[model samples]
Target: MNPDIISVVIDKLRKLSPEKASDLTVKNAQFITLQSLDLDSLDTLQLAMDIEDALGMNIEIVNFPATLTIGQLSEHLAEMRAELREPA
Candidate 1:
């Protein structure tokens, strides 16, 4: 998992769920699962949208379900990064 993506996830998640703000650190965000964040459905949806906006990719919730660890989510987004890369 890319540290960059993990940082974005932590930053966005912290802003969305301020109660857990302190806990959502970039270093550990990858180890935690989204389900463990205890966010309501709305927060989760907004987090997805925030991540999409930050990454400039269409992130489907199905592809990045709450069951996935944050590291796994980063892996998914990193795959998107590779897919979107232009030929050089």
Candidate 2:
């Protein structure tokens, strides 16, 4: 389940990458080092949107933790995805 969500987030990030921003679009095999992609702050917000769209979760930046890393983002999204799956 976590893997699925992670893949979705990664795919969304890839799609958001500028077509000319090859530097920002790492090969799928290198998603783990996404921070190395050199995405700007705006791109990060775009990433959040992608995550929300993919997970169908409401992700407010103010509610987001300060932890800023690809692995951490994946974990956070996985947690959100799990919560979304729960009966509410």
Candidate 3:
């Protein structure tokens, strides 16, 4: 995953869950689940929405796996961004 993209995601995560953000780091976040960050379904949904708004893209949540990690999610979003820039 792009480090820049990961940083942006981490910043958004911090805004959404400041309590858990302090403990999160790019290296450790690769293996941690959203649930481990104390984010419930609603929080996750809100996070997704916030990410979309921040990045200005329509990310299909259905494409996300059930057991998603922060690294994987960041990689996926980066891929989606690349796809969007491709000539149609």
Candidate 4:
């Protein structure tokens, strides 16, 4: 993903969940860890909503298991945005 997009995502997520700000960072597509953050269930849900609204893209969490790390989440979001720009 682009650094600009990554930076924006991190900024928005950090603003919404400052406690998790320390956990925000980019990693290889499959290696971003989310376990370091103390986010509870509700926080996770709200984070998802905030990310979707910030990026103007719908994130599909149903298919992804609940154990995603911040890196994985970031990668997934970047992929979604890229997919949005591509033609069907």
Q: Tell me, by lDDT, which candidate is best.
A: 1
Stretches > 4 Å off in candidate 4: 16-32, 63-66
Candidate 3: how many backbone clashes?
A: 0
Which sections of candidate 3 miss by over 4 Å? 63-66
Candidate that beats the other on lDDT, 3 or 4, i.e. the better one: 3
Clashes of 1: 0
1-88, model 1: which lDDT tens digit per residue? Answer: 6888888987887787788778777666667888888877887888889999998888777776878877788888898888889676
Which ten residues in a row are the worst by lDDT in model 2?
23-32
TM-score for predicted model 2 compared with the true structure: 0.61
- Cα TM-score per model: 0.83, 0.61, 0.84, 0.65
lDDT of 4 by residue, 1-88 (tens): 5676566656665775687566566653245444445556665677667667877877655523457755556667677788889999
Model number with the top TM-score: 3
Worst 10 residues of 3 by lDDT: 59-68
**Between candidates 1 and 4, the lDDT winner:** 1
Best-to-worst order by TM-score is 3, 1, 4, 2
RMSD each, Å: 2.0, 4.1, 1.7, 3.3
What lDDT tens digits, residue by residue, belong to model 2 across residues 1-88?
3567657756775676555345332243234444566566677677778778777788876433434445556677777667888999
lDDT of each: 0.81, 0.61, 0.78, 0.62
* Poorest 10 consecutive residues by lDDT, candidate 1: 22-31
